[model samples]
Target: MTGEEGLRACDLTLAGLLHLLLRSSHHSSSKLTIFAAQQAPPAPGSRRQRHPRDAKLSTATPSYIYIPTTITKPSATLPSTDDTDTHYRELDLPSFFNQIPSITMDHRPQAWGRPRDDVYGAYNASYMNPNGPNQATQAPIVTGTSVIAIKFKEGVVIAADNLASYGSLARFTDVKRLRKFADSTVVGFGGDVSDMQFLDRHLQSLDIEESYDLSTDQAPRLNAANLHKYLSKLMYKRRSDFDPLWNHLLVAGLDDAGKPFLAAADLLGTTFTSPSLATGFGSALAQPIMRRYVPDDEAAANLTKEKAIEVIKECMKVLFYRDARSLDSYSIAVVTKDGVDLKENEKLEKQSWKFAERIRGYGTQVV
Candidate 1:
């Protein structure tokens, strides 16, 4: 054939093949029929000639009908009412709905966590879980705000307000942040109350061990400097393990040489020592006030006990007035050669908001 005639013949063959494939795919019948390439129609009485590969290709084509995949048949039982009055129980709607069985009905032996209510026993909610591992809380829910401390000629004095805020809500009002480590040492904590409690227990254990160990007198007990070092190491260790204790701690007491020692340590294990130290909002609000009285180590040495107490009280007063997280009630501790004198229930005297009445542009007050 010439080039144009050959091209026309190829086009006709392709069109016929595509038409056959489309019809087989969309038609109602599931069976697919594939035709061998057709030549001009054979002579009327002549037997049709077939390619040698036609029989093999026909055998290779699938004989089974193709059925598209579908979702499984639903087997839901429907409610039926009998027309004939044969023996059949009537449906009790109220009983069917109200008398539903409990999921833990067959669990006997008190279930460890829950008690059998029918036997005069109440469900115990005190236990969290009976059969599984529990998780430790890594988040601080209720937290305290700040702790402030300063050194004087006699020794160191530390103070912290008695307020534990639940997020922004002022929830607890009487939490004492000042903890007496021993007769001489005092530790003030500012951060998560739960974490503070854990550290308090730990310090209590340490104190007990020190008290029992008879060699404490000959060897040296943990002074303020030693305690600060130990705590800094602990904080850094926890931070390295990626589970840091969420707190800022102030260690205050007399050193081995009978000199006052005060230091601060934070969650990241950072430690700083000076005549004065504060944590949380106290670092911002109260530190400046305390620094005014004892600006440096020389000033702290000259500062008397009464003056130090007065300065700390003034700091606490300023915190209550300025810091939103602070409260009037607070705990104060003075560490001296004599011993640690801690008073937890001290309240700020003359703490009042009545001064706002005279402020202009507030309520009905004229500007």
Candidate 2:
């Protein structure tokens, strides 16, 4: 045989060997079918000639032949609804994926912007919610009306009513809004009572820490000016984070120089210092009354402590009558060099609607 015929015979033998190997290892689950090219049979009575390459092809298997096989997974058996005739059902992927979470349909104000419970499961009882930004208070409930404060010759005096109104309803009447920090400072809160309580707790913890750190008598305590600065920074930080404390505060006491210090801070961290300061409705009603006596530092320096207390009490009485949210029962504090003297249960004396009896259209009177 010629050398070309021997080469053709070697190629044909390799193709036949590959085809045989594939057929032997074929899987029943596979859909692939491979066919080897058919070559013409050798001439009648002609002997086939072998090539040296055919020796290698005979003993060695081709490394390139690969047949992909399919894996058959067993079908899951679903529970028979007809056999049980029950409404209960197991959690399934289809239902979990398709059904709307209940949090999405909640119409309550507090549930606003909550994530889909189906995707993240129920929200953990924590300050943070997963997959969403932390929520801050948008509206205040259970709120105090106003806080009034005045700096006098000796020190400062601050006052707030005991009423915590729920919407228009007067809900809690005995909530004291005055907090005495250390001995020289008094803090008065106005606005949301809950936020006020939170701040109160925070201040208490801070006071404990300060006391523990300043064990020596020579170490000066945190004065009203420093405390006011700290609180202002805290409020501003919370405001920057879009989670402000929903309360207006009045910090009253002696400053580092032992002079009376009076300042105010609101939810936005806006602050101002005045001889007489008032928040909420007091800014409109009682402010005018207090400013008449202690309008500036000169007036405050001239005003006596006894006269300052009387003026604050009169303003509270006026607030109780003019401000609907104000209460006849209130708390008052006087901070002097001596210390803070706080009265939490002061009541308006002889305050009533009897004066309206003199008006022609008052009560059942004619117009």
Candidate 3:
């Protein structure tokens, strides 16, 4: 056969195979009949006989069907009214909408599941004020009133009441504000009690670090002066960040040279050293009494430890009478060359209001 006839045969064979494949495939829906070059009819009486399969292939028209590439998913059927009723009955509709909606006209969103105001009281929304500046501690709450201290020849004597007041209320009576650092230093804290706790924990960690260094290098522990500097820097850093620790701290101990050391650091990181130092109401109430004895560095140098303790006790007594936040019970510490002599629970002696009974205008007294 000629090359042209072979090409025509190849085309016809390909079309026939495609038609068979399309017919067998279940996906094909649209049929495309392709008419290839038909074979010439045999001459009359040519004596050529065709096979039955070839005859069938010649008689049948070859076509290509287009099948969609995507498979169609079965459509979902709607539930009958009876089934729908059963489902509705099974659902917990009340639980689904259990939260009480807010009736206020304001656009602010409600805390839906919170207890009603009549039962659990209204929630504090002061912290949620969007217009307020983002800041730490607008003012201190649950505070200590005063910390009083006096310097002497040997060391420093400092005292603070054990009472932590919640505004005007004496909430906690057994909270000691005096913390001893290492063996030599005693720190007296006055101001926010919560901030005091934070500083206390921070100091404890610092003490641990100092202890490790002391063990390794056999170096002397940090003295009162060093600790005071560290605390002042920490306070100043926090203040710079606008998150100052609301505390007035008085550090008392022997200096690095084994001399007496006493200094004060406030929330703003202000530092000052004096023969007599007091914070809060102590600055107004107890300072006069302490300064009467140890007024200057010269007097402090001449003053004995016994004389200092006596003066501190007298100041404490004065504060107990004058300062409303002051308490009869207090914690006092005397830091000297030897170690810290601390008494966490000390009471005023012979404290009484019996004298007021004799006055004419006293309680239940007739004018």
Which run of 10 residues does model 1 get worst, by summed lDDT? 62-71
User: lDDT value for candidate 1?
Assistant: 0.72
Error of 1 at 226 (Å): 0.7
Q: Stretches of candidate 2 above 4 Å error?
A: 1-135, 352-361
Deviating ranges (above 4 Å) for candidate 3: 1-135, 216-220, 352-367
Query: Candidate 2 vs candidate 3: which has greater TM-score?
Result: 2
Least accurate 10 contiguous residues by lDDT in model 3: 83-92
Q: What lDDT is reached at residue 333 by model 2?
A: 91
Which ranking of candidates, highest TM-score first?
2, 1, 3
lDDT for each residue of candidate 2 in 131-215, tens digit (9 for 90 to 100): 7653467788789999999988999989998999999999899999999998879999988887898999999999999889898
Q: Cα lDDT for residue 171, model 2?
A: 89
- The digit string of per-residue lDDT tens for model 3 on 1-367 reads 2222322333444435433444554423323322222233334564321222222122321221111111122314323323111110111123212222453432212454565565667778897789997547658879998999999988899999999999999999999999999988999999999889999999999889988888665687799999999999999999999899999999999887998999999999999999999999999988988889888899999999898888888888888877889899999999988898999999988676776688898898898
Q: Answer with 1 or 2, whichever has the higher lDDT.
A: 2
lDDT of 1 by residue, 107-170 (tens): 4323533544766456666556677643343788889998999999989989999999999889
Best by TM-score: 2
lDDT of 1 at 95: 28
**RMSD of each predicted structure:** 20.6, 20.0, 24.1
Give the RMSD in angstroms, all C-alphas superposed, for model 3: 24.1
